[model samples]
Target: MGGVAQSFGPFSVRRLMDGVFEAPVADLRHLGGSGPLAAFTAGVAGSTLPMDVNCFLLRSAEGLTLVDAGCGSAWGARYGHARAAMKEAGIDPGDIDRVLITHLHGDHALGLIESESAYFPRAEIVIPARDFAFFTDEAQRAAVPAARRGGFDVAARVRRAYGDRIRLVGEGAVTEGIVLLPLPGHTPGQAGYRLGSGENALVIIGDALHLAEAQAADPDLGFIYDVDPVIAGDTRRRLLGEAAEQGWALAGGHLPGILRARATEGRFVLTAV
Candidate 1:
């Protein structure tokens, strides 16, 4: 499905597509547990699976809020349409009052800046404090194994764009109805943004569950980039459980289609609404 918009409580959320990319099956083997990787890719014809990159545009009486910036042109042609998608939804980058970053992952934050300029000129970029400190620390980044060094570079570039406009926040409401639901382990301070109250609420699970088919069916499945798979799995279970019990809607950063979901039989069942 194409990028769609939905409403809940006082917020209007529009799903903005950032294009798609293929992920190698070998890389996700660790998340499969005893379920063979072949089972995960059974229907797929290729050696890699396509993952959708999505960001959210939320509007309320208070202001416009973007859940995650998305992968810009920097990531190449496979995933760099966030800005265009936003415009298609009748929202502009400069009009975004707040940019709530789920994490500093290259795809989630690269769109925050373009050529070292703030993409959302007037927006206050709200970021998790733990992530801000970790990704921006040159020494700490260098300490990360060489394979993961590129993450630090992307974070540094995004940091340079926000400058003073960046606001570091801990667990709690970053704005009017938007609450930060901590979902660490994916990143040092990765989180999902909770909007609204009671049954009408929606939680944007940014990178908390990358492969929806595998992770949603089995929360224990770990992504390759999870900083702590065990903790991440626990967080996923708890959050999904709460969502199931409370009847709260869900949106994932890499979900295929129809962001709305509910946990049934310990698995997330997607809904068109």
Candidate 2:
């Protein structure tokens, strides 16, 4: 929560741990049950998985930019500590000039609003074009399960607050040294931001792969929250492959801290950066 979590070129990335939660192993399902269940569960501690709810702050010559927002005042006592986290880091909400959202999920986008208004009033919100179109489409709500409609509600709230300040982007440069890479499947527009290139590269993938060890071992394992488990699995594997080959330092919405990917025969080994 203090100092640099990882550095990429001139950018210093720091993690802001909002809260923690326990995910039952039962919630993790494999694609068509094709992956090795025994090995996947064996990598996990027990039936319950304790994961960190994290967001990152990216500092560079371009100004203050946040990778993603944590759960705001909506998710209850276990979350919604953004203000406190920012205070601890000696930063004010207004100081953040831009916010690059990885997706439109509740935990990823709900922090945009605080006290029924824009929390980062001065910041321009950057979101994936696909996600903006999907969540904003009211007709898509009927197709999505009622339980998964929370992200839709979040999209509405964010739009109502930020209005024209939101910018829809594709897979390209969102700012100086930051490149948006489309890695959909969990959500239609879910993506990661690549900072720099090659071994020193740091990729911020939010909710792309939740259980670091298990998912890295077998990306075929998808979480219950995934909108399209099959596509999510494919995306996970693709991202893992890219990360490993490039020797990327990875960060995520649910990861505890920064990790580097090492490719073995068929799996990736995550080492703390």
Q: What is the C-alpha lDDT of each candidate?
A: 0.78, 0.85
Write candidate 1's Cα lDDT for 1-273 as tens digits: 235567878988888788876777666644446565556557567677778888888878988888888877778877778787777667677788988989888888888878878878899989998888888788887777777666677777776877788899999978887889888888878888888877798888888877765676777766577777777888877887787778778887887654455767647765555
Instruction: Locate the minimum summed-lDDT window of 10 residues in model 1.
Output: 29-38
Residue 106 local lDDT, model 1? 80
Over the stretch 145-189, how does candidate 2's per-residue lDDT look in tens digits?
Answer: 998898898899999999999999999998889999998989999
Error of 2 at 185 (Å): 0.7
How many residue pairs collide in each prediction? 0, 0
Q: RMSD for all candidates, in order, please.
A: 2.3, 1.8
Candidate with top lDDT is 2
Q: What is the lDDT of candidate 1?
A: 0.78
